[model samples]
Target: MKVVFFGRTSNGKSSVINAMLCDKVLPSGIGHTTNCFLRVEGTDGNESFLLTEGSEERKSIKTVNQLAHALHQDELLDAGSLVCVMWPKAKCALLRDDLVLVDSPGIDVTTELDSWIDKFCLDADVFVLVANSESTLMQTEKFFFHKVNERLSSPNIFILNNRWDASASEPEYMEEVRRQHMDRCSSFLVDELGVVDRAQASDRIFFVSAKEVLQARIQKAQGMPEAGGALAEGFQARMFEFQNFERRFEECISQSAVKTKFEQHTVRAKQISEALRLIMDSVHVATQEQRIHCMETREDRQDRMEFIDKQLDLLSMDCKAKIKKITEEVERQVSNAMAEEIRRLYVLVYKNELHRHIEEGLGRNMSERCSAGITNALQNTQTEMNEGLKPLLPAPVREQVDKLVPRQCFSLSYDLACDKLCSDFQEDIGFHFSMGWTMLVNRFLGPKNTRRALMGYNDQVPRPLALTPVSTSMPPFPQGSMTQEELMVSMVTGLASLTSRTSMGIIVVGGVIWKAVGWRLIALSVGMYGLMYVYERLTWTTKAKERAFKRQFVEYASEKLQLIVSYTGSNCSHQVQQELAGSFAGLCQQVDVTRQNLEEEISDMNNKIELLDTLQSKAKLLRNKAGWLDSELNMFTQQYLHQGR
Candidate 1:
């Protein structure tokens, strides 16, 4: 509890506090000795110290003189600055009970009354206005309390008319003067400020000589009579009034301090405890709801994951079957296509004028066609497979699988040259007397019948006929004795031989026959047989060679395309399956991670709920305790008011 002294300068404001302390701990003089605000409070032990404003250094005050000197040194130029004087609680009864006395610089000295009040008087439990008893309350002193009344709610004020002992010089007017001061001070407090009623205001005002009280108290403490020399006539009565004022001041300050300071704090603590309890309860509920939500979400994810696993198994099986079927279909289609292309190879060779270098030009042409055909087939297959797999996958996985489709399943180092299909064809277009009879016979009979007979001869001539070897073993026969059949056999066998020496011998024999037969017979026979032999050989050889090439190329090309179909189809199928599987696997991993996170969140929420539960209980207990204390404080305030009345 703090009691602040406020009045005009030289009105003994510091002397009032010193008189209460019963020591000259504060610097008090006729001038404005209290330059700054000084707050005197009690310390725990005998250790008395002076704490200047904005300085931590403690100046020891072992005696009253030392304390006075310390206070004098701390006389700050600014009236708002404060110096705290700590005296031993054992020495002063008021200090021992937590009573702090603040002595301000004269109110009339500074125009900054608001700064002075805010700095020293706002929290003061009791304001003691030290008015000079020799004079009426000054406007500055009255105006100061008016401001205090505005800020504080019904502040407890005591008007101590100090230097009242001076009234003894005019003893005849003392009673009238006392009556005038009492009426005016009481009217100011009751009518003007309206802080209290006339009765309470009467009790608040006092006529006291602070100097006489201090002097008397000091002399008494030193084992001297309380009355000193040159005393006023009513000095004893004045001392009694001063003690009466101290008694009322103590009661008012203690009660006012409780109501003003502790009551507000008690109310605030009650509100805080209740607010904390409500907040803890709200947090606990929120955490429980969040934990439940996480659990439900985790359960839903688990169910989704199970469904995905089943779907993946089914998709895997279905994919394998589809791939197998597609591979077979590709092989069949590609093989048939290639076979048809090879069958038409002769058209490419013949129509494109590639007969001269048919092997190179036909190989290059077929290679380009094969590459384009196979590429188209594989690309189409890949597209179809991707489309088929897309519908089977989940939405998230499908998009990834679509993007992951292999661009090209088959990459070849070189084009399909169809090497075996472009083999060298033996072109034989030579004349023979063996075909001379067949030509003459074909002219009379139909061409089909002639072709049948020639085919029979063609088949036998290349075989090792026993009769042709017998000719070489037989005795030398004259050309004149030989029959036409025997001669024909000899000539045909000799012509069929590939050796140059045999062909040269056959040519010499034909020349000899020409010479014997004469020019007319040889020339007419040669002209007829030569034209027929040449025409028959050309047609037969060309047709036969074309048929043989087409047959061989078809077989070779079909085999090559079949191999390509198998490899490319299988590879594409595998890629599609891998893409699907990989996408599904990635999605599964994400789901698992989400589940893990949800589990952790649920666990965390559980812990938070538990913690909030504990805090809620503690806050509830604190709220109950504060409520009890607040009720008791209100009860005590009511009792005090009744007693004062």
Candidate 2:
């Protein structure tokens, strides 16, 4: 039977072992701590201690202090190290060949200590959890025991609440405190750790002062008075509980050998056999259900894919038709909307008596009014166009597109198309109005002063009369009359003056008209055949201007409608395609996962079913051996108890 002591730092785990041995064979103190695990057992003939560090040769030591020093030495102690102390049966009766005591270092000190404990302490027949009673079970203590309870094979756990002497001064308060600690530790072990039940755990709890016991034993060994000192008094007070614990621990260890190990192996083997059978059955059922589900999902996915494909096909076929229809609808709505907007803009422009501003210098007022009108028209058209297009799109597609295409999305699209149309119309109106306004201004203001003279402003100033010869001056004529030569020169000079004046007027007045409409007219003339040219030039009137306006409006509307159709159709189609692609990909991945999982589960179930027969045979063998051992141990227990009675 192997008993292991586990606790945190400075909790007197070494002291507890010393009390049990009734000898100072193990080091015990805060400064003289057990850094490594110390495994002590009784030797019948020779007493010896050996320290083993991994693959290194065992180093023999003669005394307990030397063993402690060697364990504490950094160079000597390697990973997974331990000190084995062998002593004569005279020193300690409990340290027999069959029973060994392992004193472990504080659990909170190092991480490697846990691995060390797990390596050597798994098959322990009994566990002594030496917890500090001055406080409740700490985090380290709970954690250490929680871990120990998992790996330990034995169920006989003894919880020693060490340092119980601290509470001796106040008996009533100490009892209350002890009760609280018991309740808390039990809760931790039972509820938190799930290692033991409340009733069984409460019985295993032993309150004793390990330090007092150690001191009492040491003084008694030194031939001093046993009951005189404070240590002896405390030890006497707590000795009964400690002795009771010892008796139970011994009884548990004796039972642990044949009944515990054999019965556990027997039960565990049977459980494995039963558990494997259940698992195989469950896996068979689950795999079959999963395979059926996969088939159903595959059919469902096919149906869904076909439906989606059909929808996409129909959408593609009707794509152009839908675009045309939607374009017409949008154009009609926008036209109606713009008509109202244009009328509103006209009303606003004409408001406050526009004819009044015309009289207030047409150049200045017309410039300001035209600029203000264009701005107002632009703003109002944008608002009206957006409102018109807003209802054209269904909410779902619109919302999706809104995220994809930012920057006022629908409004920006509507505005771009509407603005293009507005710009075309504005250009026609501006061109015609500028020509008409310039003509009207020049006619009213008399061709402007800049064009009235050829060279300078002093052109009308009279020059000094030129002197002539006596022969030419003989005849004094009337101021208005002239001879044959003078008459001819006067007529020729008047004709040249009239021609120059007419040419200057034509150049200034026809500037814009000649550049625009007049050039087109010239082109038509040059291109037309003989009689057709003459007829077109004669028939080309302002009626053609009306035709031009009608043509410009149609072209502008058509261009804008096509642009709106192209952009919106592409965006809507892309959004639909993306949504379909994502959904299709996800469904494909899910189907793959489901099918793969079902296959793997079926394969695993088939493999485990083959191992069931072997497990059954093993379980039968374990049960037979365990039964024979149990009977033998029962006879021994009866004999021992009867003799004691």
Candidate 3:
């Protein structure tokens, strides 16, 4: 961890550092002196880098040319040389342990160096934006404050009120002056940066004269000068822990001096971590609406499949024309855009030729392979989208089918030749990353909607439905802890740094002796100072170099993780969609068969009942016929008897 210090041009950062170091390791007393950033560490010797040509390399100081805007990004041609600023290494201290405190180049009222210094400040773990007690929040201070606050959710922001000394004989004047200054500072911070609500602004802003404080501590320990008990009292309590200070007295005072230096550096690390956690928590809340929204899934849409594919085909063709336009523009601009590289015709031609080969020949050779990289990237993206939708699914289906995504997938590319070619159709320009095309073929193609979604952050969530592809051929940044083996490698690297600094210190000392001005004692002191300077410089440089390399390591790791997450999100989404479709089809089939069976059974039962009724009716008719015949015979007998009488 590193503790980086920044302030306005003439504030007292160098003075404060020297106070901690207990010696004027860094020469300070002029206008905007330390131009380029220099990393300092505790060491046993002195070394310095001189300004002129015929310059001899000394221990303790490194003076490189001011870093241009060119090297702001990770990739740079002179990155190796810039990484070499380190000094004054220490171990077994609370504040500055393995700490690289960057004394950034200060920006006055000028904007010339503002952007450059801004970059340096951004790189620090904690930002200590120094404000003077006199007219504390100046225009430049306000600007830097806003810039840092906007860009960084910082952990520790320290405002040091430098050069405050009150002689008791003039108590009234000093008290009034101090009170006014403190009140003004409080209001500025509260109104501008919002600090007053927490506590007293004066308490937060420590009033310390660096020169006086350093002198007080050294004299108090050595018994050379009277301790300004009043001044020393406040400085001791707030800036450093009393226990650590006392512990120093137990050890040899000289070693305690070094320990205090390192302790200050370490404190910033813990402060940064604390402040970051607070801000993250403030924004980290998962909203009820978000929870509801996040779980929501798009309806299981099927009809759009054919429609979408056809639309995409047309879009892809339209994309090709746009891509062709861009490629032509790119080709035209290539002469100017790549002019520097054009000097090396072979390398330039090689890259151009390779890109062309990939597009014209290899691209068509195996379409699957050509698009495989992107297809893989899309699947991973789909997984992320699925995750965001996970909570929104129905409870029953939520657990089982929540992660599903449509599997009909394709890859396409988009290209823009130049600005004018793209300006008219700017909306389409962001659509695809086209490799190249012939005069006739503008090449553009990719996965439709998912490409656009991955452009922002939070698009890479690890849910099954998350949709974002790892675009760009470059590798991603790494995250998480380093392996023990890797850590061991770093320790080895650190040991190497320690050795180099020690050796550098020795050479610087020897050089000072060789160029002795007068007495042997003076020469030796100069030699020793040179040695210490070199050692510190070496230590700081090695640390910076290590950090630069670590960045590369991190990116590589992240790329690998991105691929994994995207794949999981895609596969999960597809599986859920497929299962849902299958279930619906099965239910429809079941309902149709049941309906057919019921109709057949009703027809059979009706026919049987009608047949039984007909038989019963026939029986009744037969009985009635028998009765009629009997009645007719009886009537005929009665009529014959009446005539005989």
Highest-lDDT candidate: 1
Ranking of all candidate structures by their TM-score, best first: 1, 2, 3
RMSD in angstroms between candidate 1 and the native structure over all alpha carbons = 12.9
- Colliding pairs, model 1: none
What TM-score, computed on C-alpha atoms, does each candidate reach? 0.60, 0.41, 0.31
lDDT of 1 by residue, 1-645 (tens): 888888888889988888988877777765337778888999897898888888899988787667666656653537788888888888787788888888888887788888877777778888888998888977888898999999888898899999999999999999999999999999899998998898788789999898999999889888888997667889989999999998998778767866677566656765675565566556656655665675566566556556546654675566556555554554454345445554564555443333334445434543464546545645664565456545444566567764544353453222334444334533333443445555565564444445544443344434343464456667965435656654454454454443444577778878999789987888898887788767766766656666655554444444454455444444434544454454445444544454465457556656665675566566556556655655675676567534555
Per-residue lDDT of 1-645 in model 3, one digit per residue for the tens?
A: 445666776677776665665555454655335555545554433433222212344423333222222123224222112232334343213223544455655657346544644555555554455556555567777676767667655234556666554323455566686677667667666666773444745444556666665666567557765355455334553335323322332232333223333334334533554454443333233232332332231111122233334544454354444334433333333223232222222321222233343233322432333245434544544443344333333345446442233345443322212222212321111111122111112212122222322221233335354267766896764645667644544454454456565788667766786687656877688688677656655565545554534443333323332333333333433433343334323322332333343334334434433443443344334334334433443343345323333
Question: Against the unseen true structure, what C-alpha lDDT does each candidate score?
Answer: 0.68, 0.59, 0.43
Local lDDT at 198 for model 2 = 78
Candidate 1 global TM-score: 0.60
The count of backbone overlaps in candidate 1 is: 0
Worst 10 residues of 1 by lDDT: 412-421
Q: Mind sharing the TM-score for model 2? A: 0.41
Q: Which candidate achieves the best TM-score against the true structure? A: 1
Residue pairs clashing, model 2: none
Order of models, best lDDT first: 1, 2, 3
